[model samples]
Target: MWRDPGAPADSFYEVRPECTDVPKSRFRIKAGKTLSARKWHAAFSPEGYLDIGKTLSRIHRGGIHPSIRGEVWEFLLGCYDPKSTFEEREEIRQQRRLKYAALKEECRHLFPLVGSGKFITAPVITEDGIPILDPLVLLETNTDNGVVVPPQDNNAGSTMAPSSTGANLEKVTDKRTIQWMLTLHQIGLDVNRTDRTLVFYEKKENLSKLWDILAVYARIDTDVGYGQGGSLTE
Candidate 1:
């Protein structure tokens, strides 16, 4: 998960003074009670900011239970603003979803091969319902003939000529879009090779989700590019 758009970058690591205001006795999770939604609401200030020191102290004292760990970690990781009310947080979440969707759409447009599926075997279709063969397929078919097929357009019952040669294929010159595609390719390769032993990463859907998240982050923060690493560390 990404950091909250509203929070300072350093807020994630720095301890806030108010987080320690609670009495030590209240710091730990109550016996047998996990950090439930109700308790989390109680820990926030009326103005919306979470009492980070207090909340962290409580978590440190008792530790989060497994059942609520996913939800609780969202707050810990800055996915949600500690100061936000439930409704406000929900709105933020929705906005982030829309932003991510837009980024994914841009990625698909820039890289025709990119898709949100276990396997992108379907042919790419033009606006007028003509099916454009995947570039990989075209390349394989033309390997012996030495011809490169261009993206075909069949708008309103009209056909466009195929590109002359593979060597003359149109190249993406926009540095940003090219960098994004490169980052996307690297992420897929890394994800596939990094966690071969992990059952969770074995799932195609999980891999796709990881790719989508990294892609969205790359687009959101252009300064950060993909790095080579093992799957777990990545």
Candidate 2:
């Protein structure tokens, strides 16, 4: 069911110090019970069938525990079917992760800001898809004293030859890659404001993850590409 745009959210997930002054009642789940991680895992049998009917009923009534929100969302978002076996689900997740890694590599090649543990807020690519090489342009990095450790590009290496990582990017003339570059700035812009005050996004890596995820999405979903509200939805 769609929530009315004018109606209040069922619950507030983020709680900054500024938000602590609000009454707790305002944040309570509708049914007084959120689905716990233990119960969620328990719903899957040893053979790996998820009791989706019960799960949906619980979520409809109370939402999910914050601790398992992302995990539960994988199901709600159709990452896997309720009847999928554990082995099948694991296979799907592994394949999806490999695909994500490969896509990130492609984005990294187009704009090194990706996988550099830093995020961009200013426009980096022009309308013509030419990238600005300002080394100091990155806003912030998720690092230990700013030591960035890029995500491994070898996750998909076993399935395919390693991607050409340090090729002369100046010769990049692929239409799809160029189109993807054109949207990087907007993705970065939206990422900068998305969850900026939330504790989860306090770490810059999460911000980078958000940018790369959307960048890759924009690259693949050419019809819809990137939009202003994509980050908010993410």
* The best candidate in terms of TM-score: 2
TM-score of each: 0.57, 0.70
| TM-score result, candidate 2 | 0.70
lDDT (tens digit, per residue) of candidate 1 on 86-131 = 7798789899888877876775444433344432222333333333
Name the runs in model 2 displaced over 4 angstroms: 1-27, 30-33, 130-175
Q: Model 1 lDDT vs. the true structure?
A: 0.53
TM-score of 1: 0.57
RMSD of 1: 13.7
- In order, candidate lDDTs are 0.53, 0.64
> Per-residue error at 43 for model 1, in Å?
4.1
